[model samples]
Target chain A: MSKISRRKFLAGSVAGGAAVMMTPAKKALAAGSFEGFPDGMGVLVDFTRCVGCRTCEAACNKEQNLPAPAKPFDDYSVFDEIHHGQPRRPTSKAYTVVNRYETKEEGPVFRKIQCNHCNEPACLTSCFVNAYTKTPEGAVIYNSKVCVGCRNCMIACPFHIPGYTYESVINPVIKKCIFCYDTRLKEGRPPACVESCPQQVMTFGKRAELMNIAHERMRKNPEKYVDHIYGEKEVGGTGWFYISGVPFEELGFDTHLPKEPIINNVKDFLAVVPMVLAIWPALFTGFHLLATKGKSHGHGDDHSHGEEGH
Target chain B: MKKLATYGIKPHDAEVKADGQKWSLMEKLLLGLTLDQYLDQLKRNKFNWLLALIFAIGIPVIIYRFIFGLGVVTHASYDYPWGLFLGFGLFCMVPLSASGFMLGTTVEIFGRHDFEPIERLALLNGLLGYFFAVVYLLVDLGQPWRLIYPMFVSWGPAAVLFLVGWHVATYLSVQVMEVSTAFFEWIGFPRGYEFIRKGTVGLTVSGIILSTLHQGALGALFTYAPGKVHPLWYSSSFQWIHYFTSSIPAGLCMVISVSTIVILTMKWRCDDRFINNLDRITLSLAKGAAMGLITYLFIKLLAVAHDNEWAYIATGWGAWWLFEMLAGVLLPMFLLAVGIHNKNVLLCRIGAFVTVFGILLNRLNTALITFNWQLYQEIPHMWEIVISITIFAIYVATYRFILNRLPILYQYKAQAVEEGVAVEAEQKAAVNA
Candidate 1:
C-alpha cells in the first residue's frame, strides 16, 4: 500500500500537468481572441460556382477510402433524401455529403457538409482524451487510438461534422474529415474535394488570403453574393468558409451562432471550478467547526437517542 | 424476507450469535439463514422474479451490445450521440446520487447527528448510484477499456468532461470510504472502521469539493454545445449552478425515496433506532429537499430571466418545460413544504418520489429530449430502454443486498450484545460472591 505504483506516479504527473494547463484564469488572460494561424491554409467556397455536381463528394470518398455508399455518387436522386426532417448529413460511412437546399432566388444551392476545421474547434476543446487536434495547417484531425468513444466531440461540434462508426464492435471510433491532412495538407497541396471540383468552386490558399479573396469577390459583385461570408467570423472562424449567393440561413447554415469561440461560453463555469476547489474545503471545514463547536463530537453518541435536528 | 420473520427468525445484524458463536462469511452474506432457507426466501419474493425477467431479457441484449456493437442496440445517431445510456444513467443517476455528500455534510460536517440514522442509507445510495452510473458509462463508452485514457494516457484538462471524470472518480472513492464504516462494522474490522471514523471530517469535506465540482461539471458539459441544447433548457453562466443546486434536492429526495421503500418492504430488518428515527429524519431530509427545491426553482427562473427567454415560454417546448417545473419542482416543493409543516411522512415520501422523477425529467430533457432542438428529435431504440431498466434493477438488487446484510438500515447490535454478556457475567460473579 505504501509503494507508489507506476500508474499512480504517471497519473499524478498527468493530473499535475492538467492542473497547470487548465487554469481558467491563466487561459483567459493569456488568450484574448485567437482568430487563426497567420500562415494556416483554408478554402474559399463560392456557392454561385457550385453546380451541385457531387464530384467533391466522390473525390472525398475515394481519397478517404470510405465504404461504398448505398447509392452511387452520380445519382442525383440522393439529393432528395432526408432523414429526421433534415437534409442528408455526413455519416460515418461518408465524411462529406452535398445537401441541396432550394432557394427562392436561386433554384437549388448545394451546401457541402464536411468539417469546417475551425480555428478554435469545439470538438478539440470538448475532447477529454485530447483525441482531436488542430494542426498548424488548419486541419482538425482525430487520433482514434486514444478515443474513449464518449461522443462528447459529436455533441460539442456546432457544425455536426464528426461521425461515430457505431457498427464496429471492437474498434468503433470517430470518423470525420481531416481536410486530407495526411496526404494533401501535410504536403502543401489542396484537398481532393477542393482540387477535384470541375468548376473550381473552392479556392484553396492561406486563411488570410482566402478571407481577402472572399471579401473581394463579395465586394466585386455585391448584388450577386450575400454581404456576409459564412464562417469568416462564426464560431471563431473556420478553415473552410463559404461566400454564398443566397443567405447562409437559407442555405442551412446556423447564422445565429455566436461569433466568439464555443469555449468562451464554457469559461464562466470553468472559472468557478478552481474557486470551488480552493474555497469549498476551508469554507466547509469552517462550517464543521462552527456547526459542531461545543457539541457532541462523534455522531455515534446522539444518533442512538433519536435526537431531533434541523 | 417478510415471510421469514413469521417463523421467529431474524436477519443477521450482529457479529456474534445468541449462542456465542461467530458467523461465517457465507452465513453472514445469507443473513444468518441456512442455504435452503435463503433459497426458499429468494424463491418466495416476487420482486426476484421481476428481476429475473429483466436480467433474462436485458442481460443477453447487453452481451449482444458488446458483441454486435452499440449500433445494434441504440439509435446510434451521431446527432443524438448520448441516448438513454447517458441521459438516464450518467446525467440523471449522478445528481440523484448527490445524497452521499449532502447527507455526509449534514451528519458529519454540520454535527446533525439526529440525521445519522439515515446517513448510511444516503451514502449507500450515493455509492451504488455512482457505481451503476459507471456501469452504464462502460456500456455506453465506445472503448470502455480505455476509460483511463483521460487519467493516464492522455489529458484534456480544459474540457468539462475531464473535470467530470476526475471528480466522479475521486468522489466515488470518497463515498466508498464513507460507506465502508458500515461494511467494516459488519465484517468485524474494528481497525478499518476506526481509521475511517478518524478521517470522516476530511472525507466529508473532500466529498463536498468533488460533489460541487463534478455535479456542476456535468451541466457545464452541455455548455460546450451552446447551440445544440434548447435555450429554455440551457443557460451558459447558470447551467452549472442549475445542475449543482438541483442535485441537492435530487439527492435528498432519492434518499427519502429509497428509505421510504426500505421502510415499507423491509420493516422487519430495521432496528428500533432506525424505525423510531425514520419519520423525523425523513421530515428533516424533506426540509432540506424543500429548501433545495426552492433554490433550484429560483435559479432556473433566474436563468431564464437573465437570458431573457420569456418568449420561449409560449412555445410547446416551453409548455413541456413549464409542466416539468410545475409538476416536478413546484408541486414537489409545495408537497414537501406542506408535509414538513404538518409533520406528514407519507406526503414527504410522495414529494421525494416526485422530486426524483423531476430530476430525471430535467436531465433527460437537457441531455436527450430538448437537446438538438433545431434537429430532429431522437427516440431511443427499444433495446436501449431495456438496458436502462435492467441496469436500474441491478442497482436496486445491490442496494437491497447491502441493506439486508451490511447494517445500513439497521444498527450493528454486536457491541451492545457484548455489553449484555459483560453485565451477565458481572451478575454471575455477584451471586457467587
Candidate 2:
C-alpha cells in the first residue's frame, strides 16, 4: 500500500479505538444503577430485637466525639421530648438518635436514625465542592476542609441526615455519621453503634450477605417481622437495612421515597445542560448571522434607525 | 438659563458650572444639583426617610449576623437549611434578572432594533440582579470566604449545583461585558465601547445559553427533594422546564416593571428617546410576557397531568396552588392580553407588576412554603426578614446608583462626537506619517 493509504488506515484504527472506549462508559451513566463495591460492609438492623436502650446512640456520640447532649443517654425521659410537634432527630451534637413509636400492632417500636450511607447518596451527589466521598467500605464521609458550607447537601439528603453546626461563628461545617470509617470499619470491625447494641439487634457484614441474612430472618419468623427489608431497594439500596415488626411508615420512615436513586430526579436537567451548552451558541450565533447578513455593511444605518424615535 | 430636569443632561452638553469649569464627580453624583437643592430633595421625599429608617434598623442586624452567626439572625433549623436569604434573594432575584438575556436575544440576535432603547436597561438589570444574588449567597454561606473552593479548590462535576456555580459565575461575567458598553460610553471611552459593541452577538448568545441552564438548574435543585416539595409543585421530569419557562415571563415582566418605574420616578434621567418609546416597549414586553404565561400555564397543566397530580388541586395546599395560578399566572395573562389588545399602557404596567409579584410568590412557594410539606411550616425569623429587606434595599440603591450615572436610559452623544473627532485626528496622523 502507498504511504498515504497506510497513514489513513492508522488514523481510522485510532478513531475506531476511541469510539469503542467511549460507548460503554456512556452506557453505564445511562443505566444509572451503581450497586457500590461488591464487598462493601453494611448493617442489618432488626428493629424487633431493639429494646430502646439508647446504647447505639451513646456509642455513636462517644465514638464521634460529639458535644455533650442536653440530656444524659440513660435518661429515658428524652424520648418524650418533642420539638415543632416532631420527635427528636439527630442533631449536630448527636450523630444518631433512637425514637420510640407507639404503634397499633406493637406496643412500642424503637427506630435508630442516622445517615443510611446510601448506594447513591444524595448528599454526595448534590455537594458542589466534592466535600463528600463514598468509601469502598460503604461509609459516606465528608471533608470539612473543602466544604463551602452551602448546606445544599442538607437540602438534597433524602434522609435529612446531614446536620450543620450553625451556631459556630467561625468554621461551621456539616456534621453527620461516617459509619465509623475512621475508627472501626476501616479496621474490619463493626461501628461503635453496631457493636454496642446489647441484643445483637444489628448484624454487620457484607451488604449482599446482610441482605441475605435479613431475608433469611424474615423467612424464619414471617409473623414476627415485616416481609420486606427496608433500604434493600430504598433510594437504590442503602448500606443500612432495617427489618421491623411494625410498618416502617409507623416509625416515621419516608416509605414513599422512590426506589430509584435520588440523582435520577436531577438527571433530566443534567442531560439538558450539555445540550444547551453545545447547541445554543451555534443556534443563536446562526440567528445573529442570518438576521444581520446583508446589514453588516450598513451597520452605521442601524444606529440611525435607533436614533429615529429620539 | 432654563434648569434641566435630571433626564435633560444630554451627552453633548457640557455639565459645567457658570464659570465653564467641568462638573466634578461629586457634583455629578449630586445629580447636578447644588448642595442645598440636593438636601431639599432628600428631606422633601418621605420615601427616602423610610429607606433611611430601614437601613438604620437592618444594617446593624446584618453586621450582627456576621459577628454572631447565622443562628442569631435566622432560626437556623437543620430541617430548613435554606432561609429567606436564598429562598427569596437568590431564587427570586436570578429569575427576575432573566430580562438581560431575553432583551439581548430580541435585539442582537433577532435584530429587533426598536427594542434597542431598553436593551441597556435590561442588561444592567440582569447584571445587578445576578451580582446581588451572589451577595445574598455570600451572606448565607457559612464559609462565605471559601466560595471559590467550588471553582478552583474542589470539583464536583456530577452535582447540579456545581453546574449552577460555574454557569452563574460565567453568566455574571457575560452580563458585565454586555452592560459595560454603556459604562464605557459614560466614562468617555469610545474605543472601549466600540470593542464591546463588536462582541455583542457572542456575549448575547452566551448569556442565553448560561441563563437557560442555570435557570432550569435552579428548579432541578428542588428535584432532589422530590418528597419534600409539595406534589403540586414537584414534577421530576418537568420541574426544570417549569422553572425555565416561567422565568421568561418573570424576566420580561421585570423589565416592563423596571422600565415603568424608570419612566415614572426617574423621568428627569430618561432621554426623549426613552420617554417616547417607553409605552410602546412596555406593551411589546407585555405581549411577550403574555405568550410566556400562556405557555407556562399549559406546561404546568401538562406536568400535573403527566404526574397524575390532578387530585392534589382540591386540598388546602391545592387551593393555595390554585390561588398562585390564578393571581400569578392566569390573572396576569388575562390582564396582559387585555392591555395589549387595547394598547393600555397603564393596564400593561399593572399586569407586569402582578406578574413579577406572582413569580416571587412562586419562588417563595417552591423554596420555602411548599418545601418540607410533610413537616411543620417555618416562618422566617424577624431578624432574617429584616436582613432580607436590608439586602434588597442595598440592591435597589446599587441599581439606582448605576442608572443615575450610566448612559443606560439615554444614548451618550458625546461619545459619538468623540469617536468622529478621534477618527479624523487618526486620519490626519496617518497622512502625516
Candidate 3:
C-alpha cells in the first residue's frame, strides 16, 4: 500500500473508533409498551368475587409440595392473625397467601397475594447469576443451582413475593410462586390455584384476552368496580392483573409504583459504564502526559522535590 | 547491642545491624525485633486485649453463621435482604477505599509529586478496604462458594452488580501492582520494582477507571429498587453520580483521617520526611475534600429538586436526610474551609473524621435505615453486629501488619536514596554522550 493511503486508512480507523465511542451502544429499550408474549397466559382476579376461603392457598401448598402451615388452611381464625403489626405475606413455606383488608365503604375485602410474574421482572433483571428466568409460558421460574443467595432479587421485587430459605445451612435458595410452570402452565393448563378457585374469582386465559375481559367487566359494571386495572401498567405490566371494587391502595397495594419497568431506573448507570471503560483510559493517560511533560527529562530535581533522604 | 523493640522501632538506612550481620527477611518481618521483644510488645498493648476480647466472642458467631446459616446471625428478614454486612461492609468500605485511585491520580496523573509522601499509605489503605469489603460480601452471599459463578460460570453483564464484581476484582489487581513497587523495593527485587515503575501510568489510569465505575455502580445497585428506597435517597439519574462524586471527598478525607491516626499512634515508625510533610499534605487534602464536599452537596440538593421531593423534607426521613447532610457534609465542609484558611492541621483532621463518619452514615441510610421506608424497620441482630465488628478488627490487624513491615509509611532505604541518584547519573551521562 502507498504511504498516503496507509495514513488515510489509519486516520479513518481512528475517526471510526471515536464515532463508535461517542454514540451510546443503543438507547435502552423503553419499558411500558411491552405487553408480554402473544399467547402468554395470565390470571384476572376479581376482588368482589373472592370470599377469603383460602382454598387457592391450600391448592398452591399441595401443588408446590410446600410444608404444612402453622395453622391449617381450614382455620378461619388465621384471617385475624398478625405478626409485627402487619398481616402475614408469603414465606418460604407458602407461595401464595390471602390477606383481608377492611375498608369503610366495602367491608372486609380479601386479596390473594402472590408473585405478580411481571412482564419484565425486577428479580430477573437484578440477579447477577441469571437464576430467575421469564419463561415463554409467562411464568417467572427460578433455577436454584445457579443462585448465589445474594437476596438482591428479594430486594428488587416490588411485590415482596420472593422469600429465602435462610435457615437452611447446606442449600438455601430463593422461594417464590412459579405459577405452577413445571406441572401445569407449561403443559397448557392453568395453575393449581386458578383451578381450585370455587368462587370463580380468577379467570385464566391469554393475557391479551384477559386484558379485554378485565376492561369489559369494568365497563359493564362501572359502579361496581373501580375505574382502574391494577398491574396493567404498574411496573410495566404484570401477567396477573386485577379489577377490584375498591381502590388498590386500600387493598395494601403500592399504587404509587412507576408505570415503567424497574430496569428503567438502572439504565442511566448502565449506559455510563461502557463510556467510562472506553474513555477514561485515554482521558487520564492524556492528563498524565500533560501533567508530567518537560518534568520527565531530569529524574533527580524535577521529579523529586529534594526531601533530604530521597 | 540492644535489640529493637517492635512498637516504636523505625527502619533506618543502615544495611547492617550493630552485630555486623545484615537484616534477614524474618528480622525485617519482625520489625528488626527479637522474638522475645515482639511477643512482649504484643502482650503489652491494651488495644490488643480489646481486639482479643472481640475475636473471642465474635469469631464463633461468624463461624456459626456459616454452619447454621445467615438466619441465625442476621434477622433473616426477606424484606431487608442486606443487613450490616453489605450496608456497612460492601457499600461503606468501597467508597472509603477510593483513596487508592484518588492519590494515584494526584501523584502520577497530575504530576503533583509533593503528595508522594502519603501516596503509598493511601494506596495500601485502598487495597485493604476493598479486600475486606469482599470479605464482608463473602459472609453475606448465600452461596459464597459460587462467587466465581458471576465471573466464569454465568454471565449477567447487564446487571449492575456484574459491573461492580468485575471492576472491583480488576481494580484490586491494579492496586496490587501499584503497591507492589514498594514490596519489590523492600524485598530488594530491583527488576520487579523497575518493571512496575515503567507501568505506573497505565496502572494508575486503569485504577481511576475501575474505581469510578464500581463506586458509582454500588449506588446504582439501589437504583434497581426505586420504590423501596426513600425518594430522598433514590434518584435514578443522579444516584450513580451522587455516589461517584461523594466518593472523592470520602476518599480524600479517609486518607487524612488515616494519616492523622498514623501520626498520632505510630509516630516512631514514620520518618522525618513523612512527619514533616504530613501537616501540609493534610491541609492540601482538606482543600480537595472541601471542594468535593461542596460539589457533593450541590448534586445531592439537585437530586432532591429534580425529584420534586422538597415536600418530603417535612417528614421524618427528610429530617434524617438533613442531619446526614448538615453533620456529614456541611459541618465538615465548614471545618475544612476554616482549617485550610487558617492552616490549622488539627481542625482539618477533625473535619476529616466528620467526613468519614458522614460517608458511613449516608451508605448505611441508603442500604439499611431508609430502605423499605414504608416497611417496618429492621434492626440487625446482635450476632450480625458482632460479626461485622470482628471482621473489621481482622481488617485493622492486617492493615497494621502491612504498615509495620512494608515501605508504606516510611521509604525503603537502599533504592530510594542511593539507587535513585545512580539511575539519574546514568540517564544524564546517556543524554550527554
Question: Which candidate number maximizes TM-score?
Answer: 1
The two-chain DockQ for each candidate, comma-separated, is 0.43, 0.34, 0.40
RMSD of each: 6.2, 8.4, 7.4
lDDT, candidate 3, A119-181, per-residue tens: 989998888778888888899999999888888898899999999999998789999999999
Interface RMSD of 3: 6.4
Chain A agreement with the truth for model 3, given as TM-score: 0.87
Clashes of 2: 3
* Over 4 Å off, model 2: A1-31, A296-310, B1-23, B415-433
| Clashes per candidate (backbone, < 3 Å) | 0, 3, 0
Model 3's alpha-carbon lDDT is 0.83
Off by more than 4 A, model 1: A1-32, A298-310, B415-433
- Model 3 docking grade: acceptable
Candidate 1 chain A: 10-residue stretch with minimal lDDT: A301-310
- lDDT per residue (tens digit) for residues B145-204 in model 1: 999998889888768898888878877887898888888878888778766666667777
TM values, all candidates: 0.93, 0.91, 0.92
Considering only chain A, what is the TM-score of each predicted structure? 0.88, 0.87, 0.87
Off by over 4 Å in 3: A1-33, A297-310, B1-21, B415-433
Better of 1 and 3 by DockQ: 1
